[model samples]
Target chain A: MPGEDIVLRTEALQKSFGSLEVARSVSIELPRGARHALIGPNGAGKTTLINLITGQIRPDSGKIFLEGRDVTQMDVAGRVRHGVTRTFQINELFPNLTPLEAVTLAVCEREDLAGQFWRPLTAQKAAIDEAFDILTQLQLADVATRPTRTLSYGQKRLMEIALALATRPKVLLLDEPAAGVPKDESAMLFSVIAALPADMSVLFIEHDMSLVFKFSSQIVVLVGGGVLLQAEPDVVRRDPRVREVYLGQAGYV
Target chain B: MTTVSQAATDPHSWLRGQSRWSYFEIAFWVIALLPFYFFPTYLTLASQIAITALFAISVDLVLGYAGIITLGHAMFFGLGAYAAGLITKAGWGEPLTGLVFAGAFAALIGFLTSFIIVRVRHLALIMITLGLGFLTLELANAMSWLTGGADGLRGVDVWPIFGWFEFDLWGYTAYSYSLIVLFLGVVAARRIVHSAFGLSLRGVRENLTRMPAIGSPYRFHLQKIYTISAALAGVAGALLTQTTETVSLETLSFQRSADIVVMLILGGTGRLYGGIIGAIIFMVARDQLSGMNPQYWYFWIGLLLMAVILVMPNGILGGLSRLAGRRS
Candidate 1:
């Protein structure tokens, strides 16, 4: 994998909020097809890093590179077009609109058909087809016609991922994709996320250790606004620091 | 799961399912046509209703679809009124071109102000819109040479509709002209709301922040909708000037902006027909009530507003849906 191109990279990103440093010289990389986890405690600034990566907020000093191209100055929409996108921990969806309508809009956005106003939505058959395909992939096709608000919490979570897929991002960021979902649906949700197109690298944040270790091939543990460790799951599991500070396993290992 | 792929291959049927013409929609339009036959004497009021309905629809686009409420929407309306009046006074007397000029002029101003509007939200947005409205009113009053000031634009001479059918004292030509324009505006608006762009406009209203994640610029969408709404509102104003043969300061007043909002709330927003229905009821109520008891008309209107709000929090269409046991 040495010659493989990295899909996403961050260079010594520095950010602080008043007296507290949220991101301190934090740097990480995801190679093509990487499924990486971002794990941290309550104040580890995991969400902050996600916000910075997705260009929702700017960092004080740092650079973000997507597919070897610098994208630090890019806005959220610019970053999304450049193949980097994210799903929220809290569902951000069009409550009154059906999933089919929402997903079709997402496809239209990618194809620049959003300005097609003279014709009806039915005329965008190709975009709708593509949207349904994305919905089917996320197992959201069954509830596609229902208003997004009426969907089960699990289905709603999947809908978020379905929308992210419509962007066709090269790197997908998941901020607790399984947060608040029922246990049974949570596992299914993770599986669907885990099985996203192989070429699209995933960077996810999770507080659920079991889900993290079970799904993420690699883990980046953030502590005190910095990367404490970035390694394979086994290495992270065996590390005394992670075991003590996060796992809280004083004697098991 | 089997149904999933089938829908993936066929979205046309799914789209058709949502847009099937209801009996109510057809009947509504058919009823709108009846004023031509039955309301011969009240054609003046009918024409006014049509013009105000068009204005309400324009405001509906911003508040209902884009979720950007404004207290200064009358600025566009007034500006359009003035444009048509000024153009007619300047010898362009062609009605259709006057309408187009008015719309474009207001749209230009709308586009410029949208940059300021879309950048803020909630209370701040409302204040900015109110400020814009006041500024427009003062501008109209200060520039009395062109606008005719508080006395109104005196020499707005509108040409015959379609180079035929001159406006008359009985209000036949004016009613027909305004109604036709309003109908065309409705058709155009319905097409827009059912388009991919229109759905995205709803998306902007529902979740502004989420749009960027899908590579859609939220601010750009808001600005576009605002400009469009402004343009339509301007056309409605042009209709007023063309029909009445004058432009008044009241066209740009704070009251005009507030009244449209009230009308939309009464009819329901988002649904394209809400503004139309609301305008009819509000205008008709004003006429009938003022004729009977001019000074207390406001009291009755206030009462009606309270009752409507209390009984139907979502307005007429929304309340109707609820009564039918359907979630709108």
Candidate 2:
């Protein structure tokens, strides 16, 4: 893998809650167009790491680089404007808006029309078309007019992806995209993920090993708030240390 | 599938397909026109209703759509009233010019305050707004020479509408002027709420966290809306001052702010016509009830309010919209 093509890089990231250090000297590099997976046991600070990367919470120390531009000091909106976007572990959608409306809002924001108060949103022909395209691609076209709150868990998850994609992000962080979906539904979700543009890098955190094994090109195993291993999926599956720490109990190796 | 394509092809399809102007709006206009004929004697009260409705709509813009809780909105209202009144006192009593001065002055103040206001949320926002309202009230009271202190600014002589229609005791000119302004204000507000900016505001209200992730600067949008809302409120105040031919410290009072909020809630929040409907019902009801028994009228008003809150928490228009099976 060419490391020089890094799209997202974290250097010695550190964070603590009171006395408990959740992230300690954590450094990660995700190359351009990489399909990356972050897997760790509960309390291994996976969420804390994501928050640090997204600027939801500031890390005590270290820097975050997006395409070699230091975004460590950027606020959430600033980072998003720099083309970094993420989906929540739980669906965070505008519940009252239909899928079409929600996606249209995202599209409008992306098109820099977020402040256009004079023209009606429906008048934005290109935005509406693009929003519908995104919804259709995510397999949410059937329920485009239905309010998001009324959607199924699987549909909501897809809508979350659609919202994130609407921003046309350079790097998309998906926090447990299949978290609440059934096994059969997750297959559909993963397929949609797999169909994403080849140039867009994706970093996801998932507990489901099958999905993880199938989706990620590279896997980073986190243990005790530190990187235990980083390798290709096949290599990670066979590693004895990885087996001893994680895969051994599941007997996946 | 065809609907999507059609929506894309015809730009006005989305605008026309949606029920923007329903019977409620039509009924509001009809009722607004009624005071001109049947109750010509009460044109003064009608003008008051129009002014109050405009103020309530301003409150609704922020509180309803943006989910910002404010308790000191009268700061802008009073500021506009004083600005307009002071201009007239200075012998520059051009009604149109005074209106512009009031709106711009109020908008300037709103823009300055929003830097602080948009930084906080929920209870802090409410308290800060309340504090601002009281602060302006005190400032107005202390400047007795300028604001006439607690006694109120009096002897404000407004120019006739278009330099022709003098404001008579019958309040015909004032009522018509206020109604026209109120109509324009509602049209502008309707345009705003239907626009992309308004959708982003709703998005922010629904999920603050998700908004920034989607590239919306939370404080920026809030501040923008706050300024727009304040400008509208100021216009309302100017209308009040112009019609009443007076500016008073009560315009900036916490009571004024609170009452407008209550009226907005009673009418419904978020909906374009909520404030107008709320203002009409509230002012009309108050006029009737207070006329019956001035001292104990509030007791009846309180009882009715409690009943409305318990039965339809969304307010009169919201409940009515629900009955009509339309989204409030």
Candidate 3:
């Protein structure tokens, strides 16, 4: 913890959509190089919390900080510029673009490649190179040139993560990374997460108990839009409140 | 220094090193010089081709690049022609000034009209554009004093290009003038389509949500594409007025709007050359079929369109491109 910078920390975060309170006074911290997990019931506001962190939706009240810098008011893209990248719950890959093209475009956005339009897509060697590297790391090299629409659902999901990785963020947020993916492909994702850059911090929301236990070093539980418990994966799994709120006494917790 | 990452590690590195412009430039030159050596027997037909080709290309920019489906694009072209005709008849005299004014005027109308149009999508957008075109043409018909009513404007003098070329009513000057303007329009459209701004438009067309997720304001880019497309449509209109030396309220008719859509669809939507081919084939079919039987030509045209739609939903070039893609 001495060298860790607490890459992302949220203080008393509160969010409500109209009359629905989805996140309530949630306080959370992600260490400099920590792999943190947010676990909760189906409607525990985990997605809302991730959305607030990435500025996809504004918090009704509370603050989000990245690398000790306040990013409470930044828009989604602005947060991306500040090194926060997020993978959506549903795959958002460009359906017609190849995985390589998708990653290349993400690199273009990261490097401000919009102005290089007249220069030809081929001229941005460095950005393209970096994109390729990111795609390769995500195990997308095999389907690099295949249009995303042609890829299997698992590959499309992987491509979505590759796109987020292409931004080269200091803090990465994954929303249900293992949801809807094949078991084999889901395991591959864990391997990819384990292989990310040492300094990068990842905060993930997942419902898959196996994925959560395998990848998370720390876990925070949210029940009914509020923090239910925060502890190591094993401890949180055993917590009675987590059982009562998420497991409901005798079910999948 | 660029490090060569292994293909096993990253297969797309090859794409990172290739340029998309060199290929585009080569294709552009081939198309631009094509008409010069292949002028048909009648010069009037050639001139008509040039004008219609420019119009088609203009429509393609909005349809293909911006992903805007407009059936009323002729509104800008028709406005440009009528504005130029009226201003020149009022002693503006110079074709260049008339043309510039025409584009400016049409662009202004386009800007105002688009604010109401761009907020809608698909069928609603098409209907709004169609309605806007109809209303403009109707208004033009109602104001006969300036627009010559349903009779059409006549005797509008267009001075020669650069004061040296007198526009002859015959094929000679009209053909050459249209050829030059069409070439210029193609060059400009190509530059715009290949430009960085255009790339952003492509991005928006590909995925609207992804654009803002990457920090782009999609609405601003959409507006820019709309304005530029209108300006292109305006130039095509101005060229038509210059060649014909007359403007009819019919220029803005719903039929003309429908014709543009047919032309784009027949050629291809997003592919640049689709417009040119669509226009040429459409006009030639109209001319030949009408010669055979003027009264029944619409029947053949309708049948031909139906066939094209049923056989190739992407139009000719679009279908061919997909075929080539599959083979590749």
Candidate 4:
């Protein structure tokens, strides 16, 4: 496929921590609206790649393009304004704000209306309405008024997604969206992902192969801090290198 | 009960429910008209209450809503007082003009200090502010020719409000004027604390990481609050200088800063009006105890403060609100 339509591209990204190299000249193109799964074993630099793209940490040398815009030097908030948002592997919702309030805050931030502190919250009806709609879409309408501290692990993870969605981002970076989800909830989460808008892209890091195989349009296998291969799921399943690195670890021939 | 529900439905519910406004309004009318009947001793207590209350509310801008704890608030208070006193005694301006200049001077000090202050957190920030206060106080004392050093400024002629209400030597005009300014200051402060900016400030206080991630420049918001807070403290100090017609080196002392903190905590931090109630209670207690026995009074005051601190951790007003909430 032509890379011109790509929303996010990392060009030979490199990062190292003292003697340990986390990412070394890694490159990839995530096309617009592509449901791309980044599958890797532990210490395979999945999170490091996510951080580099999101500007949490600077790469030693690389160019990051988000929607035809270079965002390599943008600070965290600057990156957010550029439409790059990520949910933590560990859920990072505001502990004290209600789910609706947290999502409304995100929506407000995206609109650049956060500085207006004189207006009452109830006056921001349009923002609140949009936030509630996102919460309902994520099956969190019942818990919208509940403080995130009281939500179940599954709900908290879902709220994190809802929080990210409120930003109206074009590219959503979900770091292990199913990390702590129960089996039933995992299926529900996959279905929810399967039902998202065709124009919005999802790039997620996942360890669960079954869920990855079921939902991903394309799989990018990462092994030892670099792209091992990028291909269709069936091609990935047949590749010996992928088998040796991942399936071998789980002792499945 | 009816008014409570009405308050909930009102768009201005935040203003209506604020104890700071309610208690301040009540105290304003009572104290403003007190000179008509009360003894001169009572009026003196009222003037002290006005000054102390102004300081506490100014500190509340940072402490209660912005979640910053300052131990050197007296720096702004003392600076404002000294600046006003020096200006008036040197024949620069009238009472109101002196107060405004005092505010501007304090605002400059606050703006410069906030660059270093906003970067630190908690205990370290407190220590830095404390050191700043002490440094200013020493500087004022060392400049004895202008400030009167160990003594204080005499011959400070503040005149009167509007050039007609000449302040009676017994302070009739001074007490009424101070009470009026105190009332307006409290109302203005109430508006700010309940504003949308105030809500965001609370959000920042709740989580700094989340605030910036949602598109706020955390440092800018913090610095703005700090500067505004200091200016308000300056106004309070200038008001005191106007009332007493004197500025002493003690305005910048660490004890005065500590006293402001004690007033805020005693009324209950974060409970808007707690500052005013705390100030009134503290000043009244101090006045009564000191009048009864000048030597043994401080010991009794300390015991009383300890009792209030231990018994009502949320302070008098906070405890009362909680009780009211429970009953409902």
Candidate 5:
């Protein structure tokens, strides 16, 4: 199933923090339009893999290829511009900006309008429209004009995804899309995320196996910083090793 | 400066409010212009306040809006002073051109140094900027032949507005010219901070790491704002040189840089008008205190600053806005 349509590929990624090996020869591939879920127990280096793929942290050894081009040497912004983007588990959003303004900022950034000082924001009608559309899609259109800080926890978390979507990323890495979200809102959040464009590859880190089993086309179970199994939802659910990894963990129901 | 409805019908309407004039803003500018006609004797002091306010605004752009904590912004101000003074001393004394040239000169230096400046953050950034300020001061002092050394760059001659009005002793022309420039600077600064670029700057300041995920490189935005801030500061410095006919080593002094930071904090940060209000409050307090006790004026100024800060931690303007918000 490893096709030429892979949008993101980590070739034998290895990282270590002193004596602690967080990622040991971790390799993963995300094909175009793939709905891949990265499921693992706590301290499984799920976030570390996302960080390496998004250029937030350097791997001790490996090559990160975006659309088959090596991007390991690139910076975070450079990689993002080349169609790699990620959302934080903690909801890293601009508290000072409205959802519309924040999303417009991302769209302007995507279109490279961030440098245009002469034109006012009103002049970027197309970008603003696109930003509003992204907000609408996220069901954040009702509160689009309110300050981001005033939004509910669920809404703010969705705003994070809105920002990622505004970048129009080819390879979207969601580091636990519903980290702090309540159980009821988590399903709704995943629904919005699951409705993202088919042409965009999505790799999400989710502890909620229900969402993972429900929304993910494939699941990659990570254990001890290494890929234990990469297969369909049923295969991952039936794997005994995967069961052992999450035995004591709250994630395995 | 902008307000949008929670349920706006049109997407473009969100930006429409930014262009509309606020009554309070108009009244503020009008009151700023009133001092020229009402209190002519204080015009010289008023002009100096305008220049200082512009300088403080420049600092605000870099530190407040861009989230760059700099302790040595006087480097650009001093560079502008010397550039304007030297250009006039070279026999071309066009006031408007001097302002533009001085701003450009400072911007050039800012852009050149931004490579090193934009790469650092927090305490390291503060030290590097302070180091840069000191380097400029020593360089200017060392080049006494060009800058007139400790004696100050003297004989800075500025021609009248369109060759009609001279920079008189009463400071009629200086007050008019400085106010106009300050007004334009405020307008331009307001426009920049409210634009898409400015919005992104706020985003960068809010979360430097988050910008990359959205595809806006933080370093380049910082570089652009830093350069723009330097240009405004240079223009302010050039205004001082042109109006006073002198450029001193103190322009680049650490005290000058430190003072603007105080004024910004005393007034507010992030907001554009904070700097101007801070300059006025500080300059007025200094003037009144110095007159009462010339030798121990610092004590009084320090006391007054502490009182203001203790009461209004967000600076005078920020506190006032919060009060107004509560009342409304």
Candidate 6:
């Protein structure tokens, strides 16, 4: 059983592809409601780790725990139903559906109404209201009726977040949420992230140091397929090893 | 603030302003009623179009909405035909009962087969579906005593629908029965496509990778839709068998499967009415063109299909909808 205080915990997670070790005995713990940032240089297995946690790929020999329950054996959908959800590094919104339709699906799924077929989706007034409420919170109400494909890059990124948030997830995993957005729009995106409910735990992998420094309460640095250092944001910022491994390469003092 | 309040009260406002009845749908119903008045002698042809449209709609559910390309959907249709035919031959000839039995049997087969079919994707899915069709065809052919061999199951006698309306020579009963079934099927399919479950199936089609992340088990939803499609296809088969009073090997042929796919593509995909419009256009064209020259009818059909494809790559209805500035 996972401890009550820790919402998500990985124990000695390891993965390898042929001769390459992408993750080696990596262990991390996320406390309840913690805002954590995972930062690493390129090729440091950040994506691979996110994949393992979300059950996209299995870890060779390790355990994953969610809310004190072992979920290492759970599939992606099972993990999601258990209140874990994630956004793609690249946008994965349904191009044919409007943002309202897409987010409504997420909301309906969370409400256990995804199997309903006999009634019109519009009849789910409460789900629609909840979905609209989420869109409003994400500042996407104006464009909710437009097809997702027509949205600008930054809007799509936020739409992806809206999709994730609509699941009512206890732990949200964001994989490079601001990867392709313009720098100017990314600030708006981060501000929205900063405004998420306080009880929701978040683990995000990002390349932007400014957003990382401003948003994360705690920072975990990954290097060479293993955890290099995990500490409070300020300590991680000032760590010599962290500076040598990441800040040095990215020209951040 | 008023917009939000109006949206809350008018529940349908959330559907992106799409209405249930479009001019096209209204026109379709009007056209469906035409055979009863103008050409009573051509009721058989109208009934055939209705049944074929039902089959095409089944294909659309999987191919258009769920994105599972199949080349052997006729297996379910044929199974349903055989089941209904056998039931009538056994002296229990209630039309509705036979339809239910046939549909359920076909759904059972679909449920069993989907375990393997849902595991593969792309070319492998097509091959497996095609193989299943052939396998069932061979089984039917081998069971000569039961299936009547290549000559086909014969002497199927259907009881009058509800013991009131008799199957008649002028094809009035067949046409009305088929039209009613087609109407019910269309309503059900439309309801499904507009539901949350339907949306998830589209989600699976749009991105298999992201469906599970959003709490939809990919294989489960595929299996569910596949089974439902098979059941509906079975209903179409049952309708055909009951109307014609015969079940033939042609019903199981790969060509039948391919024709339905072509009809679906000809109409449009992903849209509920695409298959219905496609079947009407394809069958009507085939009927008229084939009457002109039975020997080279395929040549004319081929030319017409080529023209349709070249002019509207998305499909006939898809193109028309675009021209009308309607959101698909």
Better of 2 and 5 by TM-score: 5
Candidate ranking under DockQ, highest first, comes to: 5, 1, 2, 6, 3, 4
Order the numbered candidates by lDDT, best leading.
5, 1, 6, 2, 4, 3
Give TM per candidate.
Answer: 0.96, 0.96, 0.85, 0.85, 0.96, 0.95
Residues A29-135, candidate 6: write the lDDT tens digits: 98878889999998888888999999999999999999889999999989999988999998887988877888888887777787787878878888888888888
Determine which window of 10 residues in candidate 6 chain A has minimal summed lDDT.
A244-253
TM-score of chain B taken alone, candidate 1 = 0.95
Encode model 5's per-residue lDDT on B1-328: one tens digit a residue: 2344423556677666755567877998999888778988999999999999999999999888989999999999999999999999999998899999999999999999999998899999999999999999999999999999999998888788788889999988998899999999988988888788888888988888799888887788889999999999999999999999999999999999999999999999998889999999889888888888889987876887899989999899899999987986
Q: In model 3, where do residues sit more than 4 Å from their true spots?
A: A2-20, A55-75, A115-118, A245-253, B1-41, B90-101, B108-118, B131-135, B138-149, B326-328
Is candidate 3 or 6 superior in DockQ?
6
In order, how many clashes per candidate?
0, 0, 0, 2, 0, 1
Candidates 5 and 6, the one with greater lDDT: 5
Clashing pairs in 2: none
lDDT of 3 by residue, A98-181 (tens): 677677777777777754434656556676678777776777776777667999888877876787877778888888877798
Per-residue lDDT of model 6, residues B191-300, tens digit only: 98888888888888877887788887668778888999999999999999999999999899999999999989988998868888888888888889878888887787
For lDDT, candidate 2 versus 5, the one ahead is 5
Q: Tell me how far the alpha carbon of residue B6 in candidate 6 is from the true structure, in angstroms, after superposition.
A: 7.9
lDDT of each: 0.89, 0.87, 0.78, 0.79, 0.90, 0.88
Model 2 C-alpha lDDT per residue in residues A1-253, reported as the tens digit of each score = 5667999999999988898888988899898888999988877788888888989999999999998899999998888888888999987899987787788888888788978888977677788778889987887877777668998889999988999999999899999999989999898899999999988999999999889999999998877778778889999889887777764363321
Model 1 error, position B160 (Å): 1.3
DockQ of candidates 1 onward, in order?
0.65, 0.57, 0.34, 0.30, 0.73, 0.54
Q: Model 4, which residues run further than 4 Å from truth?
A: A1-3, A117-125, A132-154, A186-197, A247-253, B1-40, B168-172, B289-328
lDDT string for model 5 (A1-253, tens) is 5467888899999999999888878888889999999988888899999999998899999899988799999989999899999999998999978888999999999999988776888889899999999998888887888889999999989998999999989999999999988998899999888789989999999998899999999999887888888899999899887887778654422
Candidate 1, residue A46: Cα displacement in angstroms equals: 0.8
Q: In terms of docking quality, how is candidate 2 classified?
A: medium
Interface RMSD of 2: 2.9
